[model samples]
Target: MDDFRLFTSIRYDPELLKVPSLGFTNVGWNSKSSPFHMLDFHRDRMLRAAIYWDWTAAIASISGQEGLENLERFLQGATKDLVNGPHRLMITLARDGSLGYEISSLPATHLNNLYPEYLPNQSFDSDSNISVTVRGGKVPIKDPMYDIFVDSQRTTKSEFTHYKTTFRDMYNDARNRAKVNPGDKKEVLLLNEDGYIMEGSISTPYFWRNGKWVTPPVPRKFDAFQGSGGNDGTTRRWALERHLAAEETVLADSLVDGEECWISNGLRGFICGKVKLH
Candidate 1:
């Protein structure tokens, strides 16, 4: 089968300046079943996510003085070509005032790597096949660090936590480390400066404690703890709105205290696993 394909506005055009824009929407096959809840919140979510990329020029150009209208027009056109599938669609605005978008699909095998059984509104549940490891080494500037004060106060001056920029070297490192020494893992959970469980490098980490599903609290600049960091993902929102999950502070060593563990992202939705700290 095809390794999935991409339909991006930048593919054909070579002179685009590549200005950063925030917005991505992914849907499962059949176009109607969006397992990650994209159907209900993708548009709004994209707008909210755009806050992370709110550059001065981008904001000034699109803010007051009829600029917002033009920006909306660009957003509508950029996201218009998206359709349902096991795919990811992203729209980015160029610094040179160009719109770029990409729609990418994944094959069944790639899908199986994250979820053994492909189904909408379903999570990966495997025996020993799925494993997780806490991130080690120094935290990068782009990645979030835990702040106990941030958790208590609920401040919102978060910079990198809410955007999906391409700064993923730290996450990539954790994933690579998990693959070492026999290799029985697929996800890398992270911890904050104070050594508390924060989130997955690329996904939201959750645990099954007592009789309820709980996830790490969202991090703010001076709130208290390091959050799952990223926009409010559709899966996380779905779990919360449906009462499938709750938010609470979690410690790194406390990971073993849970009866079950899981990580979620737009692409994987939710992938259940067992923790193996490193």
Candidate 2:
């Protein structure tokens, strides 16, 4: 697991420049066999149960030596929480050996928080997560960790719990398929549906042209294309200071061009600088 074990610097107090070698964990690949169709997720909750163990292990690892007692308490209870509560990976900012507050999930709906950017020497490829700036040295934070996008249904479908299906897996799976450029030591990106210009895979894409940024025109009539009130082009809403994108009739041909390409998925938003295709 050397590939899993990373050596890096962490910043607890920037003034002090305290960079500890922390361990961040990602879940193993979700069983892709479970297609996120309308009928599949509810039919099979047990199959997705493995993610619980993965989370527990990661929680323990994050609290290296000086761990967070309160957060650690929460992780200890996760096993019990899994059987009775909702299933999702947790993100913690570990310091010393203790963990930080907590970020529940990294679904496409909230990618802007990461503030992803593109670097020239940095790059991404398929099946390879072009090393983004993560903290710690254990698993590479696997799929579904922070790449899920949820859609709520209040007075809608009889089965509104479908978020347990559609987003959790699909969001991360797309990043799993991306490629990386070996030459750039700092090059990293996520590869979802958003094209090269797109920064996020599950969320959006970014392209640099004339020092300007552009995202993809969302697919119209998409499976999850609900209105703004409900679940619409979630990828378009990643950082929406102003909502410029919408569910329109766009084709694959429209993705190319743009100086540098990026994908903005759950864990990483506007991930510019990809070296591979979907």
Candidate 3:
């Protein structure tokens, strides 16, 4: 596996930083949600970002150097390092939809085990917190589809959602659980809420047949049910054009038959290494 070299930054759980000795909270999320859902709460216009799903990154360098710091300082240092081109930030959200102050180090897998945990989170408490050994290995983004993917979405979202929204309590619990079960296991397959074959630990769901990048219909779990803005959309507005494949089809009814199933997401952007699912 190759390390996806992108500009990187770090954020932290301010609470953890206040107590500097304990390990820091390392996380991130795809925070984008409709603000109108809380129209009543915003009469004063006091607002914060609300995301659908939030996850963790990692905490380490390949050389065993712990780079734990408050996010403001981390971002400043990352900018100073000058390697920060396209960056990923590690963060934690509090229960109230606020951010924590412990940004993680590089090599995201250390945060939540990119492979398994990111898809299906785990559960842990003060009793659990296994000592993480095995210093490091940074796997560069394997799919060239990512850098292009994250940026390709120039389409306007119907509503406003600030996912990767503020760090919250649910987010904190999930992050802690990931420690007990690091998702780096290569063989693990990511499933949806129903346990159906959905996607990989990071990749989105897509299948190739006749040389096309066709993905499953965006599931209803994340759909916006009210007026206007909803989850009915694409990771990339021009998903078909960017992948250089043609003929878009939706598997919302069912998975694409016999085509090549590849997972597409921020981490493992696109993966075609599928063996068999049924």
Per lDDT, the best of the predicted structures is 1
Q: Estimate each model's TM-score.
A: 0.54, 0.29, 0.34
Q: Among these predicted structures, which one has the highest TM-score? A: 1
Off by over 4 Å in 3: 1-74, 77-88, 93-98, 101-198, 219-260
> Which candidate do you rate higher for TM-score, 2 or 3?
3
How well is each residue in 1-278 modelled by candidate 2, as lDDT tens digits? 11121111111111111112121112111112111111121112211221322434434443333333343344445333322211233323222222332213222321112222222221223333434453222212122222221111112211111122222233344334333122221222322232212223233444444434444333222233332111212334433433322233222344343224434433332333333323
| Residue 275 in model 3: lDDT | 32
Q: Alpha carbon lDDT of residue 36, candidate 2?
A: 15
Rank candidates by lDDT, best first.
1, 3, 2
Clashes of 1: 13
1 against 2, candidate with superior TM-score: 1
TM-score quality measure for candidate 3: 0.34
Error of 2 at 67 (Å): 27
The lDDT of model 1 is 0.42
